[model samples]
Each structure stands twice: as C-alpha cells, then as structure tokens.
Target: MRQTRFHGRVEGAAACCSVPGCSEPGEFRAPVTPSSFDGPGSFRWLCLDHVRQFNSAYNFFAGMTPDEIEAAQSPTAGWERQTRAFASNGGDPMPSWGDFSDPLDAISARFRPTAKRQAVERFSGAERHALGVLGLKDDTDLHSVRRRYSDLVRRYHPDRNGGDRRHEKKLGQVIEAWQTLKIARAFA
Candidate 1:
C-alpha cells in the first residue's frame, strides 16, 4: 500500500534492487546489456533513486565511432538511402527537365500532342486530305511538309527513278497534294 514517486514503480514487486548492498524494492527496469541483431539483451530492476542515477549517466553515443556519431547528428543523415521508384503511367516517358534549356517548354512538350490534335480539328477536309496524301501528320508544320514533299518527289519522280514511268502517277499525286497544302490556311 506504499505510495511510489516514480512513473515505472512496480506495485507489489518482491525482487530486491540489482545494485549490491541496496535493500530497496526493484520497481523500475533498465537494460543490463546492449541489444543486438540476435535479440534484446538482459534487463535488471532497480529502485527509483538508482534508476535516476543510471539514466543521468546513460550516453546513447557511448561506443559509436566519431564518424558514426557525426553521421547520426547530420540533418540529411537518412536521405541518401534509395527508395522505391514511382510507377510509370504507361505513356511516353517524361522528358528530363535537365535536357531542356527552358523548363516551361519541357512542360509544354508533354501536352503538345493534345494541342496538335486541337489544331488538326480546325483544318478543312481538303487540307486534311492533302496532309494524308503527303504522308504527313495533322501537326505537320510548313517546313516539315516541304521536307516530306521534296523526299516524296525524289522517291516517285520518273527522272529520279532511273527514268522508269511506273511511279509517275504517285509523283503527280504528291505534287498535287503539295500544291493544295501549300495554299491551305493551315500551313500559314
């Protein structure tokens, strides 16, 4: 029925304090040996006064090397460890920001296909047909169209095809498509 001052005081504890020559009731627990990867080591019980003395003398960095102590005290101590990477969204891999001189342009590049689709929707049927005939995408710029037209001309032109007339029909289609797309407002 004795009143105890310490928070860890064990009621009805029969064990005597682990400290020699002390007869006080062992009411508080302290580790007798440091724990290891194998298991938690042993504990010994002590009275309130002895436990307070033990706590005042305890040093968590007691056996640690100077380097280990310094590392434990560092602000970024645990941040160097690698963590699980975020799962990708199954789309095109994001462009690395470091590769682009302009960060905003890198962000815009991710949404460019959607912007191209919106532009494609504004094109007239003839313009769209011309784009298809020239084997170009809806997002093709005038420069790209010109480059594609030149490549097609060199491929299908009878003079370039070793004077073979077999590709003359395809060559005429490419020229006509270029003519139509060149005058289209979409190219402008």
Candidate 2:
C-alpha cells in the first residue's frame, strides 16, 4: 500500500472554514499578531479568502502612539540609529583622543599615540639601518635626523619633487631612514 501525502484539506474533521468554525477547510496560516506575545498561544488556520479579509480589517498598531508606532515599525529603531558626534572642544584638549557615547565611535576614535613621535623617540635599530642605507656618519643626532628627513622628504616626496620617478623610490627610503633614526633615545 502506498502512503497518501496530504496536499490540501484533511478529511472531515469539521475543518470548518477555520474562521471561527464557519465549516471550511483551513487553507492558510494566519496570526493575530505578527510579533510574539507574552503567553503561549496558537495561530489561526483560515481559508485564503478569510485570511485576506482578516488581514484587511486588522489594525496592527491601532492603539499605539505615533512615536511608538514609528519605533515599533522600524527594525533598527532604538540603538541602530546613527548618532552625530558633538564637537570635541567640550572636554579634553585632545580632539582625536576622547571617548564617545556610542561604543563603536568610541572604539573608532580610540587614543592612538602619535607614531611619528614614537619613531622620533626610540628608533635606534631603524636609525642604524637608515644610516647604513643613506650613508650617514656615526655622529647623526635627532636634529640631524630631523633635518635629513625633512630635506629628503622635500626632495623626493612625490608631491614636492616634480614627479621624478626615481625620487619616489628614494622618498620611501628616506622616510624609512627618518622613521628609524627618530626612535633612537640617544638622539632624543
């Protein structure tokens, strides 16, 4: 015997129109509320026609205020809204270094110690390498480092150096050298 698959109405269980027992087969799954309510309940099984009727007559947010309605209607209402950051002048001297009310912005604007300053402070290893590459003598100090870095940057920086292709590569080397020398504490 082949098993019969149920494709439509179940046979003769009073299967009323499913619209409060109007005596019809429940053909559609309809809900009183689109959202989950407090208690466990059941969804209504209705014929397609009645379900359409019920849907047309239903006022989902009938009792809600305008604000409540707006809040409830949107998927991202309360927290997902993007908030504008206020001017940083209100608090700390550091504009790029303060906390934000929103966690994401606070994280994004997190305090980053200036890399250039760090490079200037403790670049001994990088300095030696830079000096070796640039052929500078042992007496180079922070002042010399700054001056050489500035001069090389000016001469080779793509923007400053009339688009010389060779200087582009040279500029990169110069920056690496300067960054290296700047970090040596002895120079500081």
Best by TM-score: 1
> Which pairs, if any, clash in model 2?
16-23, 16-24, 17-23, 17-24, 120-182, 121-183, 122-183, 123-183, 123-184, 127-180
Model 2 clashes, total count: 10
Candidate 1 clash pair list: none
Off by over 4 Å in 1: 1-5, 65-67, 81-188
Give per-model TM-scores: 0.40, 0.36
lDDT of 2: 0.62
Work out how many backbone clashes candidate 1 has. Answer: 0
- Candidate 1's displacement at residue 102, Å, is 34
Residue 179 alpha-carbon offset, candidate 2, angstroms: 11
Query: In model 2, where do residues sit more than 4 Å from their true spots?
Result: 1-15, 33-41, 70-128, 131-144, 148-188
